[model samples]
Target: MVQSLARAGCEVTLVLKAPVRTGRLVDPLRGLPGVTVHSPHAAGRIPDHAVMVPRWAAGVLAELDEADPFDLVVVRGRQIAAKLAAGPLAGRLWTYLTDVPQHPAEFTGAAFGELRRIADASRMLLCQTEELRCFMESAVPATAGKSVLFPPVVALPEGLEPRAEGAPAGRALKLVYTGKFAPRWNTYEMTRLPARLTVDAEVHMIGDKVHVDPGDPGYAPRMQAALESAPGVVWHGGHPRAEAMRLTAACDVGLSWRHPSLDSSLELSTKLLECGLLNVPVVLNRTPMHERLFGADYPLFVATEDDVADALDRVAKDPELYALAAARCRAAAEDYTLDASSARLAGYLADAFPAADEKVLAAGGGRKLRVGIAGHDLKFFTRLLDYLNSRPDMEVRVDHWSALRVHDPAKGEELLDWADVILCEWCGPNALWYAERKRPGQRLLVRLHRFELYADWPRKLAIDNVDKVICVSPHYRDLTLAKTGWPSDKVVVIPNWVDDKQLDRPKLEGAEHHLGFIGLAPSRKRFDLALDVLEELRRDDPRFTLFVKSKLPWDYWWIWQKPEERAHFEEAFRRVRRSPLLSGGVVFDDYGRDVAAWLRRIGFVLSTSDDESFHLAPAEGMAAGAVPALLNWPGADTIYDTRWIHRSTTEMAQSIADTVRLGRWDADRRDGRAQVRAAYGLDEVCAQLVDALAGHAPADLGPAMMR
Candidate 1:
């Protein structure tokens, strides 16, 4: 977002929670005259800083109000950002939802409810494809006229030279696949391209380990040998996304392959759009998801392994068919561009918050005000609490009401009798009943996280009495409002904030062949794929060491409702756990505590999550100096474009091996901590929170509250 806005001539001032060292990524922006970047003091402990997640919320919002005011504000979540957008002094507030709330396989009644709420709250909503827009609109009637079907931006550097090979008319078929390749990619099959196809093809793969490690003991060698022995196959170790795109455009055939999984089954492929932008005809796997985006009549559809050759042959044989596919590709590319979507979205920003441009500061005008939250299970709420409490001027207080109900006649009255603001997270059954009985003027703030949206709680709660409703993501907000059938004006978007001070520190030098993953194993989390990547790494590079750490209690895995899914996950996790030794039973002699400590010895971190709201572990691991090997496309098409997301595990293993072979750790070693501190860190984010809050606080929010 910062990059696109900067390119569009906005005076881009990025106030990051941390500083990320993208090496040459910032070089172009550094040369830009209008771009200015700022870093604030991290909110928590100095070194190895903890994100003061709550305080940073209001702090950052307030800072933006004090700094140059923005004409339009687009917030990612319904958390703190929503509150700031609805607050006074804010301009056009556009709540943008990247993910449609519906989880294909994990939809408990609770998850479905959450999806509905987000759809209802959005005055203006953006969907990745027209099909997604239809889904969103059908799910929520409020979105019927207000939603816009726009694809995500295919962002490339403004003036980089186009790929060396333009549209291939008569060139040898050089096929290229880029991005993260995890177990979900079905890489064993991908690496067997020569065996799968009967045509003359040279395959080149550039992959990352964002989601899983393919170099583990069981799966690595076979995958590597498959590619190594394949005729005319060249594996380029993974490179940055921009570089990969440039190189991909040079090839004759572009591969945007995806193995259908819980997440992949519903996702719109970014690579397909990338290929389309470059006017490349894609031979895509035929799936309901792809059909939704490209329509059933689209020329590119591969039904089975047997169909692969014929599809390729047809494209090879007929120039007219090739030209037609290329033309369709170019036309399909138009919808995904940032320009087309931005134009349709600007109006929503104007309508949602008419007072955003008013320039009214907080109650005391630049002074911070402390706020308090009353909730339990602080794990999920901690970040918001920390950000709210971290500002130099803001103080935060939390009051836990064990098993307290928002609608309990006695509890609701007793809970907020003396509190400044009462925050109800996932309010229980009697929420509406209690909210109705509350005093007329009590400031009642209700928060709708993922749980409330997916569950039936929204239906039971009467949101009318609540003075404010807050959500974590715009998608969540839309989901909540749609499910709860609430007014759009009643909701707000506030994103969670993190502190990333460590991103600026110098990275370790000369260390190679280290991989790390810290997460609970699940299909949603993609632990199976992580193991595959590890297996692949071991086969491609012997010097490489796989580091695995799991803090999840073992009992979680033991208690599985679905035997098969649980068994699959457990077996994979076990393989990753046992992968520290070679076949002769030799231990690597070093495995550090936690992923961060392990990063000090390793060159890359495998962040393999199938679904995440905003993955903190991978970003944190990356900040700890582990080059992020991102699973390119995950649930809801979430991507962090941090030069880490790879396309395949083969690419990931090759990347690690190449780094070890060339003694070239420095070239790819990013100043991870700096990047985290600047953008993902807690302090800078808190300031933005303050600025956003001050800019959008309700007209009568009383004395300015600091984090």
Candidate 2:
């Protein structure tokens, strides 16, 4: 891992806890470019136990960091990570955990608490497998977006080719096993393979006999005895990693079969990856992770000792089968190569620590900017607020309003007096109040969404007092300019950001048959058109269903009190109850913040609203890998792809039906996900918001402002 970082042009500093007399461990890393190694003096004391070790290491790191601050501190152990997290350097820590609990039962008491601390403190949790990443995130909810895939890196011996294609005609086939002889690894059982095989074979084993079963103290000696006594078995004890790889390269197949109890492990075995890198097929237990790496029909998966023998015998008898297994192993190993791992690591690091803008950095002059956010119902701005609060260069405070047009006057005046910049989330009464009373030299920004354009607030807003008028889309930006006759340059577009990381979850089974509709109130949302589409879909396939997630119209007095709004919903509900296909097909679910979880069951998100500034439902669904079916309302083409937009309800329903029947649902889902991510990903959009708040023009604002 250190070499991979050095190769990627990173300056790495290694701090050793104790001195090393033998250069065997640190010799290879001593002379690498941009690498520094610091070891303690020979007389320095070493901590006796695991708990004390991290504490001692933390003290040493703190002193070194105080002398010359490091950009990042990478730690492997959870104990040290949690310890450092409580210190001043917490924000720069990146944790890589190897000792993760394999079962849910193990995540109780101190174990679960410790993981939560590490999750909360660390900037990144380098996971060895995707399954482990998912499991860790699920177990500790705080670790959701922090966990990243850092799979085992394959570093093969230089200039080594794969094993020869065919087995020798007259001689016995050679098989090898490398790594620990732990009880759960089933190394002892592997030695018995030669005797059980129908074809003659040689079983060679590498590494020391180390068993960790408190119940069985003599398991190690007994295993050693069996390795010596078993016929056709050769035990090569404790070789260097490079030598082990060369030895493994000489064999036709490698042994990675383990105890069935360990099948629940989410981690990938490094020994198995090494064998694959050598192009040697491995006979391993059929775990879900292994099955995903190599296909289900990989031809060498084993469940028991007999299965291992059978797999070896089958491979020895057929040359074509041996070649096929070798090719599959090699192909699967490509993703774990050093170059691939390095590229992923570099990209993740770049994202985790983006280069600060020189202008913004210089403007603050090492002092945090005092930012005051004044708004009512900050649902759309919550993510942006959290991001700004998390930054080291900004000090943020919120002035919550009692209503859209109501707030404590004295409290607003106090915030206005203290803040360097004021951001009005909505161009509502708060914006107008701030614009009318803000003092000189205080920068003010107001963001306008759809409803505000139709309201009197935008026109009554003191435009001369405002520095910038932010809109969510170009269509609205133009509308805001024409409506209020504000300067085009002052009105800039920064689309509503969807939290792609939160919403990009795996879809559930049969999700393709489920369609989702959100926010059906006020009639303009066009709940009727959604029903028509659902009816059209059910006509072709009875399995198609519509799931509605929204607050009932009666919940809002404004919509229910209006006769037209009440009648529109009453007629729609009557039709749904009367139609045979739509009776059980439409399901109404209560609206909540758990939209990310709810989206898992939806395949297609419907946006049949008469019009919108920028409908967020379809973009969010796209992030969750769902295809979107949208009506081509005015200005809809500017925000979404024309391919997803349709002229009428019939066209929308037919497009969705054709996509499902022709097996293009998954393809369309992937395309929509990619497009939405590129256009309105949270990171990119939030960065633009930050830039606007920091007194700098957004990089992408030129095109929108010109239009």
Each prediction's TM-score against the native? 0.44, 0.80
* Candidate 1 residue lDDT tens string, 253-322: 6666555453344347788888877767777776655664566676657654456556666766676777
Kindly provide the TM-score of model 1 when superposed on the true structure, using C-alpha atoms: 0.44
Per model, how many backbone clashes are there?
152, 0
> What TM-score would you give candidate 2 relative to the actual structure?
0.80
CA displacement after TM-score superposition, residue 190 of candidate 1 (Å): 2.4
lDDT of 2 by residue, 457-512 (tens): 98888899998888888788888888899877788888898889768876766899
Clashing pairs in 2: none
Count: clashes, candidate 2: 0
Q: Which segments of model 2 are wrong by more than 4 Å?
A: 41-52, 109-113, 157-170, 212-222, 356-422, 428-434, 437-442, 450-460, 475-489, 498-613, 623-625, 631-635, 646-653, 682-707
